[model samples]
Target: MSGTVIATHGLRKAYGAVRAVDGIDLDVRAGDIYGFLGANGSGKTTTVRMLLGLVLPTAGTVEVLGRPIPKAAREVLPRVGALIEGPAAYGHLSGTANLSLLDAAGPGGSRRTRKARIAEVLEQVGLGGVGKRAVRGYSLGMRQRLGLAGALLRRPDLLVLDEPTNGLDPQGIHEIRLLLLDLHRTGTTIFVSSHLLAEIEQLATRVGVLDRGRMVLQDDLATLTAPTGATVVTTTDPAQAARVLGDRVLTSDGERLVVRGSDPAEVNTALVGAGVPVTGLVLQRPTLEEVVLAAATGSGDRVAA
Candidate 1:
């Protein structure tokens, strides 16, 4: 609870000659919305499996909640909730029925409290009104919600979700993001694995980039997107601003100029000293996209010669 929720040391998984997951170290601390990013075949899924003890590593170690996985799985897994490779349930069963059966099968949540827990999770996933409706009648988005509901039924301390917003429309995606943020505010550590950079940028407090089975980068989102000691100035006459700042100006597009300095106040004072009227002053920070592009070579699905 106080330290890492999930940690990996030199984790590797190889099939014959193909190394699906090469040497990689993962560090996921409690209270972190850790975004696990990679392209389609970057071994992201494999790594998630290993962390959850669904798949074994070829070499190295994995620990979840400060306990070694698969070794102490019986004791540790109950505190973890996951939606991996999507959710599966009997298509003929109602969402409530499916959850009831799952809760009965899993540890915790007694038979007496099953109904209340199911209702809570169903409502949490926005399916509170789908009373007794067969899952087969549900849409892909609804099924995804059902999957998430299952993961949340346990009120887990850690949530591992893969492409959590998959199959949802824009509004649904927005709702899920808000739901996740709300959960984080209450103190659940979340590990979200997805290629959706925009969502990750919005939600993740920390991120880890995977490329060709290797961990290329892992750090806090704030650190990754920290200001690059550059300031952006918006002025009517960019020419005068650039001339005022001289070589300190990096680029000028439209009314905006990118200047090579961290302090906006200093740049503003310099521009005002030169009689350059400034409309706006802002700091230049790297976007999550820019950070990932620099850390990982091409995406997971990049074609090679």
Candidate 2:
């Protein structure tokens, strides 16, 4: 937690002839909710397993909480909590019982302390009275909350979650988002991996997009979503506007025109001078979906067609 909560240098991993993670580098700052986003089979899970010491890397150095991974994971893992792939709990046991079992197997703490901690975490995760319910009887969202409570039992400094909201309803997703925001407010560094771009757009401060075992983009959400000085305009005369703008025009949307490299004043001036009346104009901001598609296709230009 001093310098970087998670850092990897030239991380590489291969399976037979296929390279899953190809010399990827990462630096996750303390107290940040870094979103690790990628398509299916894009090595997101592979990289996460390496960080947790569940799988060995072919080459590279990994440090979590300022200690080397796998070698020091045993020492460092106690201060870290994770819910990868899915929740881990016995179907036969009740939610409360599962938490108790984890508490006993975890770090050294008195029985009374453990009990109090369990109740506190259960409430924090919005599962206060449902602890007595059997795990098998609980809904998918309820199970997700229970899993998060188990992870928070130790009050870890760094939390890694994979698809945390995978099997949730809209309300359940909203609840989990609020819970994550609360945790981040309390100084916990969260590393979440998900295939849902919109979820990451709302929850994460910074994001890293991966495709085909390579990182296509890594930047803050604000930077990625900022207006790229492009405008989409609906006009009375599309043909006349295109002819006037010529090569400066990027594309057309049948009735509208996408013009690049022109400020608002200049766009208005050119349109009015050419006898083209503007019906509507909207400044375009890149969406996460758009950015991800652009990165995947290796096309830097914004698509307006």
Candidate 3:
């Protein structure tokens, strides 16, 4: 929970002529609820696969739990639990049976303690009541929880999840979010990939954004979502204010002007000097979705700043 738990340098992956992940450097500190964000086909999944040793990187290096990955995968993987794509399950098998099979294939989980561990994770993910039900009969939400429970069975130090809330309803999504928070509180370093910005906003202590196979931004949630010069200035006379403000105006209605990259004091001083009555000035902060879209589209130079 102190040093870097996951580190990557110039990480890249290519297929034929396509570069799925370009030269990138990333760091995930211990005990961080790190949210990995990107549009569809933005190499988020590919990056994760490389981290887990499921897919080897074509260039650069990866380290997880402070050890080189793939090389140290034998020692590193046992301490990590992951739920990628979706839960792999036998549709005919009951939930408990599926966990039993997975635990058998997994590393270092003792048979004697396995029963109690499985029950513990099932209850943690709110699937205790349905552990005996056939997985095919459970709802999509239930299946997702079961997948998460399977991951938790190892009592991993790092939990890696890719799009864990992809197909969940509102209630299910909330439950997962709560579960993740609980895990974070218990000193688990969670690296999660998701397209759901609001959900990420609620859970992530830090975030990394990928756009077109390149990392555009990575920072703490608070700084990344902080206000970035999109301010609202209200006035009695919008036309006068616009003329005084000149090119600083972004958009203007009859009563207010939404200006960009201008200080409120500067705006107010200019308006007052020009004989425009300033009624109010309020700073409007950009939302996480706004900042992310801006960076993804190359419209924002530095969203976090």
User: What TM-score, over all chains together, does every model reach?
Assistant: 0.95, 0.85, 0.83
Instruction: Give the number of colliding residue pairs in candidate 2.
Output: 0
Candidate 3 lDDT over 155-240, as tens digits, reads: 99999999998779999899899999999999999999988899999999999998767998899988987776777899989998
Scanning candidate 1 in windows of ten residues, the lowest lDDT window is: 296-305
Candidate 1: tens digits of C-alpha lDDT, residues 1-305: 67899999999999999999998999999999999998878898899899889999999999999999989998888898899978898999999999999888988768888899899989988999994799999999999999999999888999999898999999999989998999999999999999999899999999998888888899999999999899989999998888889999899999999999999999999999889999999999999999998776554454212
Q: Which stretches of candidate 2 lie over 4 Å from their true place?
A: 108-110, 234-249, 261-281, 299-305
* Best candidate according to lDDT: 1
* Alpha-carbon lDDT of model 3: 0.89
Q: Ranking under TM-score, best-scoring first?
A: 1, 2, 3
Task: Report the alpha-carbon TM-score of model 3 versus the true structure.
Answer: 0.83
Task: Estimate, for each residue in 23-121, the C-alpha lDDT of model 2 and write its tens digit.
Answer: 888879997899999876889999999999999999998999999999998799888888877888999899989999988886644578888888998
- The numbered model that scores best in TM-score is 1
